[model samples]
Target: MSARLVLHGVCVGLLFAALAGAPTPAKAQKIYIETDLEGASGVYKFSQTREKDTPPNIEACEFLMGDIAAVVRGLRAGGAKEIIVSDGHGSQAFLPRLMEPGAKYVTGKPRPSSGLDETCDAIVMVGCHAMMGTPDGVLCHTQSSKSENRYWYNGVETGEIGQSAIVASYYGVPPILVTGDEATCRETKKFFGEHCVTVAVKRGLAREAAELYPFEETRKALFEGAKRAMAELPNCKPYQVKLPIQAKKEWYELDAKGVKGKLMTREGEILDLRDLYKF
Candidate 1:
């Protein structure tokens, strides 16, 4: 073979090697999902979420898992590299068998954190209900339904959704999507702004009543919403709750019979956002 021809073949091989090591145009994102139960499709009554291992609760959890699966599928399609889903429900609602593939599920109690970190590119809240005292919030109650917990930070009344967002903000992670009832969607818009994608599965008529949407429709919305949320990652801003938060808390005092009684209040300052849910 001619020396010039041999040199041409070596040049081609070197070019291929350089092309193989080149970086792609887009980087896949690491997403974290925080999920609850009250806002899941078909869950409107307390009977469905207030207990553990009951038939009603089990069914509600299944509905939540289905909703999560839809979102996970959408995220995967949108080029998510890592996905972490945490059971944000009070009673820990996660059916391992129903969990979608290609994601890590976080369940059980005494979790160190909300399963979020600086590495996460975005956060998504699925099955979120409206804050406490929302007249149209289906099964709404902030921290505890029985105690009717309520919280205010810097004179702004907030709920579980706000609390979760504040913590995520601490890690510089923006909330890209939120899914729940109409009231919950409204709340998300009020807090996180229009850039955040919100999917409403139901319209709440009262604390325990709602116009539930069909699973097929809601799941489709969730899947599409998740994809939109990924696209919105660049537009969404990390929620900020001013630190040294002046906090106010209110809840019903327990009576001698273990029933909620008179309302009690407390006021204090929170030094860190992670402690926002502490008391």
Candidate 2:
């Protein structure tokens, strides 16, 4: 073979190898989602969450999905290439089969905090209700609506949003956006700072009823809130509620369904109901 031909062939192979090894543009950012159903717009009735074997109201599920989809849409617009959506409501309120496309859906109990960490960009919450016994909120309750009368975290009363945010803090991830009733949004803003995007889907009127915003308006708000949260990701910081987080739950009467149900844990040590959180 001629020297020039041999040299040219070697250079071409080197160029091809280098091009093949080059990393692709647009690195995918990870977004963690925690969603419930109580505060979703269009879900003002108690029967939605307290359904029997089968979900009696398909419309309720659609409302939940619509909110999830809106936030996911905004996240995508904000450059989120990956997302993990967890069902935060008790039982299987949010179905995995009906999750947003290209997203991971997790259901069942006892979520592991190990999976969420500093590596993740940020966290989002949708359709979360207010603290248990919170007056004027639709389907307001802590972990178990029927069992838990109230839950205290290091003395402060908190619902699912606060509990989950505290757990996510363990891995150094902060909650950016939280959507729920007006009261829950106020609560989230108080805990996570005013910078956090809080979207209120409904106005709490009672335990089982609420004045809901127009569906289209709410969808727009959710999407915008999510995008804003992601855009201001740098401003969001993990909310460390200080350990050992002394938590206590007031039990309900035996007649209440799901009274004996257990609360979810994430590196949490359950102390005596009366010892840590004393009246």
Candidate 3:
């Protein structure tokens, strides 16, 4: 072979070898979803009714199910390989057949330490509501409707979103996206910071009257928010609750005199319930 031709052949071979040795880009990580029915689009009441005697302006459970489906579809399109959704709401049973095929759903009351966590790369909250006593928040109650409970970490009143973020942080996972009423989304941003993507489905007025969007628009918003959240996953920081966790409960109706246990600490006239209640 001619020297020039030989030199060109050697250079071409080296280039091909180098190209072959390059590493492939990694695939996008899967997402975890935690869904609640109350903050879903069009929801404005505590009852999940869609039959006779139901309120004329009541929101249907089917509508919320569709919104959740839309979010799942969008997340899938955004390169999520797997999804696990926890039904984090009253009774934890709303729509079972509506979820996408192959998606896992966790229903029923979640234990104190059992929710979303380390198994997921990113977490998304759907149809969540604001904490108790949030101004203009729809059915704004934390945990339950009957209880006037306040969850605090280091004396700071943390909302539902804050509590959920703390749980996610326990496993080193970050809460990347949250969708709900305007008040809930606003509170989520305040607690989780600006990096978290938030989608507001409705505006509340006195917890009952609110400007709400149709199901179609809400689905679109949820889809967009999910995509944005996944895209910005790298920028999300895990929410950390500084250690030495302490829980204090003041019973309004429980009989304190009948309570029997080893007392841990007593402050003035109030007793910390943790010392008496086991579990």
What's the TM-score of every candidate structure?
A: 0.90, 0.78, 0.76
Ranking by lDDT: 1, 2, 3
Candidate 2 structure lDDT: 0.78
In terms of lDDT, which candidate is strongest? 1
lDDT of 3 at 230: 76
Error of model 1, residue 148, in angstroms: 0.8
> Per the 3 Å backbone cut-off, how many clashing residue pairs does candidate 1 have?
0
Candidate 2 ranges beyond 4 A from true positions: 1-28, 52-55, 95-98, 108-115, 256-279
lDDT of 3 by residue, 143-226 (tens): 654544555565566677877777677677888889889999889888888989998889999776678888778888888888
Lowest-sum lDDT 10-residue window in model 2: 270-279
Candidate 3: residue 113 Cα off by (Å): 8.1
- RMSD for all candidates, in order, please: 6.1, 9.2, 7.4
Put down candidate 2 lDDT per residue, 139-168, tens digits, no spaces. 888766766567777778777787778777
Better model by TM-score, 1 or 3? 1
Better of 2 and 3 by lDDT: 2
Candidate lDDT values, in order: 0.92, 0.78, 0.71
From the highest TM-score down, the ranking of the candidates is 1, 2, 3
